[model samples]
Target: MDNETLQAWVEQVSRDSFGRPFLHQATFNRRLRSTGGRYFMRSHDIEINPKQLETFGREETEKIIKHELCHYHLHLTKRGYRHQDADFQRLLAEVGGSRYCSALPGQTKRVQPYRYKLVCRSCGMEYLRKRKVNPAKYACGKCRGKLFIKMLDFVLEP
Candidate 1:
């Protein structure tokens, strides 16, 4: 849906769920990656991630809207608006808002492979490391002996 539709939806949800009118703007933010929606404390504006509607449809998106509205209403009224606040939690439960947004599919954190390995000279204990480090500055934990560094082969993707 367009920004205008989203704005209307947010305003409606605010009124229905919290009995408060959302005077601030609401829009779909394409750059939002991990969050379903965000509430700006300074602007009192709410941004819903468009990907959420595309992925989870209207029902889930409404819950996200309610979640952001909880923050919006509570913050404006000088009450606890943060996730850890009791007021926020109680209001969220009353409105049936989602505690946390579902993680987007295929958005797992990237894991870097070990680029270097440290081998102890005496004990032969080896440790894999993501970054290169000076082995001379460190000693082996198994035995107080010298250590050496070796670069591990990385498989390049085409």
Candidate 2:
């Protein structure tokens, strides 16, 4: 979703879940990598990762919004807002918000390192491998066919 829709979503989520209004802006930052969302302390604006909705869909993104809102509302109310804070954790659990921003498997945006991949043409199976492999050295476990490798785009989620 674009920034406009993202703003509306954030507003709705704030009121519906927290019973509070989000006066600051909510935007989508394409350059945001690794984290699911960012809550700006200076501007009090919320920035969400666009790839999140495109990859994981609305359900996951909403959870992310709830996660960010925990920070926003808590910070505004002068409560413990940091991830390590007790109030933040309690509110997040009560609201059923995501504990952490989830990273897509095999995506380069992942904080966890991914070293390789293996694809089986015969069975059309794609695998995320943690270490590099020689293509011709091994065959598909299921059909004994050659394997191909690809670098992930770090776009959509599984």
Query: Pick by lDDT: which candidate is best?
Result: 1
Worst 10 residues of 2 by lDDT: 107-116
C-alpha local distance difference test of each model: 0.91, 0.86
lDDT of 1: 0.91
The C-alpha RMSD in Å for every predicted model, in order, reads 3.3, 10.7
Candidate with the greatest TM-score versus the true structure: 1
Q: Per-prediction count of colliding residue pairs?
A: 0, 0
- For residues 43-116, could you state the per-residue lDDT of candidate 1 as single tens digits? 88999999999999999999999999999999999999999999999999999999988888998767777788
lDDT of 1 at 27: 94
What C-alpha lDDT does candidate 2 achieve relative to the native structure? 0.86
Q: Name the regions of candidate 1 deviating beyond 4 angstroms.
A: 131-139, 144-151, 155-158
- Report the poorest 10 consecutive residues by lDDT, candidate 1: 149-158
